[model samples]
Target: MGNAVISSDKWHPVLDRCLTISGEEEEEAFQLLENLASFMLPYEISASPLLQQMWYIIDNTKYDGNDKRLKALSVLTELSMGSADKMQLLIDSNKNARQVLALLLCRGKFDVRQQVLVILRNMLINLPSSIPFLVERQTVIGVSDLLTVMHPDTVILALEAMKAILENGGSPMTPENNEPSFSLLAEEASVHSRLDFLVSSPNEHVALLAMEILHEYIDPNDDDIILPDDLIDLTLHPLS
Candidate 1:
């Protein structure tokens, strides 16, 4: 289905239905959009009105119930996956895109927040330009809080996203090195403390990832760093 030669015009009806959908029809409309998004080319999706409609559904709080918002986020995640242009279009088309995503990260349900993290991670990976926008206070704090979630997958996603942000944003230049860094984000008390706590997580993969981020970005001079036995074993043997 991904290679099916569907004209751009074919998306119009679906876009129209999604744009005007309401009440009970909202779920069906989003479901249809999600299916279309899965196989649609990034350029085709960007050229159509689909992104705007999805943003409308996502930004409007009235669509929060009936799982409509989650569906919208799912569609977005699929659309933004491997295309830097699509990710850029989503950010450029909506001035408040970052804020809306931050709100979802902070207030949405577990699934919803997980979808948002996926979208942010995709953005950080595909579109380096999104770093400055996504690295702001609310977004950073929201991602930082996810480290404490009970779910390891969600925590891993958040950690990976933070790692990408730090890698791309880079730290400020010091006397030792001339290159800038994203240390400001890593240095945030909330984010730094969370990494410190996560370094000892029972999940060895989680602890290793957290430790890698700290080792690369964080100042090593901090006090009270505790290394767990699992981390020691994993560090020596490493995850295969």
Candidate 2:
């Protein structure tokens, strides 16, 4: 670890060299830097510099040459270790993080998207009051786009986030309706398309969750379903 720490400043050179090599040499450079990052995890100073280099390498890879996306993500958590500012950096650095997360829902392989999703979910979960207002301003715009692209995994994770919104409950600015609309039944909710997208997922876990909610809407024995006697009270009256 100590040796790796000394070499941390030299990471940009190593990453640059790694990009030039082919076959085993290239692979070795990748492994070396990866291992170096792992060893530096205990030290914040070392990790931050190394991560900045990784992000730079990854960003540069966009113009020409080989793959660096995976590596950027590999050390993403380490880069942002306990930093509240990490989310903002992701949003700023990666313009497509949101779009790709939506696109990658129907398509997987981008594990970075999942890590990014975790960050987004945490943001929503931590700031419940602020999120609905955020949602109103299009926080959930990605969910609709992901569905159109048939990205079920992204959709499912997003729905889990949306369910929190539903649990907390808010209404979008609609043409009419004075009351707050939890009414996924209403035209404003976009419920049917949302329903169709999730229900079609081949992943059993995804499909099962979709079915659970679908049942809530169309349950034959309506009496078999349960509703909080005070759902409105729970969601509507937000205490200061």
Candidate 3:
């Protein structure tokens, strides 16, 4: 808990032990890694082997149980809350990370899916390059499914992720890569109707976020549709 800076000399051994141990000891090892990772700078952790090691644990679910994997995911989520470089490292370090996270979002338990959404939200906001990968993985569909969760915070997170996607959508990955934008994908997933319902949410924060997402869905060429100045200001500076 001290401000002492963590170095490779200190963390490398812990990383190794975290991967090699099992049972409660392994759980403690992962916990220790999480603590150490929190102390290390995002670039430091992303630059180290720890990132790949965590990815290994996350990708190879057979290597351990859900507890350890979730712990590993937590570490990644923490790392991703940093600069864009760190988020890019999380994706570039593992070829399967996006696919695995998307699959988890679609089929994993509620807690796991929530964690994946947080990570995806970070990626979409921080790393522009991740948009194509996420689009290719049909991440919007997975995100669209979370709008109905009873937890307002989780619902808000899902909406924020969708907002980020729409902000970056419609840009072709390349001249010939004809992948659909996230905006189109969301429409196909019936996210618009879902947002329409959420706009009437009892929680004002949730309702506002839903309205902001709906605003993003508007066509730029259509200038007749207008939002109130206060609503625009509130959306620009979210309560969160």
Identify the runs in model 1 with alpha carbons over 4 angstroms from their true place. Answer: 2-5, 19-28, 170-182, 220-240
Backbone clashes counted, model 2: 2
By TM-score rank, best first, the candidates go: 3, 1, 2
TM-score between candidate 2 and the true structure: 0.46
Local accuracy of candidate 1 as per-residue lDDT tens digits, 1-240: 444534447556766776566776877767767777766666777677777877888888777754767778888887666456666776777877777897888888878888888888778766777776655555676888898899997898888888878777553222123423455644662788888788889987888888877876675455544444555442211010
Task: For candidate 2, write residues 13-35 as lDDT tens digits.
Answer: 77667545667776667776656
Q: After superposition, how far is residue 185 of candidate 2 from its true place, in Å?
A: 18
lDDT of 2: 0.47
Model 1, residue 74: C-alpha shift (Å): 0.6
As a whole number from 0 to 100, the lDDT of residue 83 in candidate 3 is 61
Candidate numbers sorted by lDDT from highest down:
3, 1, 2
- Cα error, residue 200 of model 3, in Å, equals 1.0
TM-score of 1: 0.78
- Candidate lDDT scores, in order, read 0.71, 0.47, 0.73
lDDT of 1 at 140: 71
lDDT of 3 by residue, 1-240 (tens): 554546545657878887667798887778777776667766576567888888888778584446767888888887667666666777788876667887888878788788888888877766767776654435677898999889998898888888878888664343124656667778888888898899889987788788766766634444533555666343322121
Task: For candidate 1, list the clashing residue pairs, or say none.
Answer: 170-181, 170-182, 171-180, 171-181, 171-182, 172-181
Which is the better candidate, 2 or 3, if ranked by lDDT? 3
* Candidate 3's TM-score: 0.82
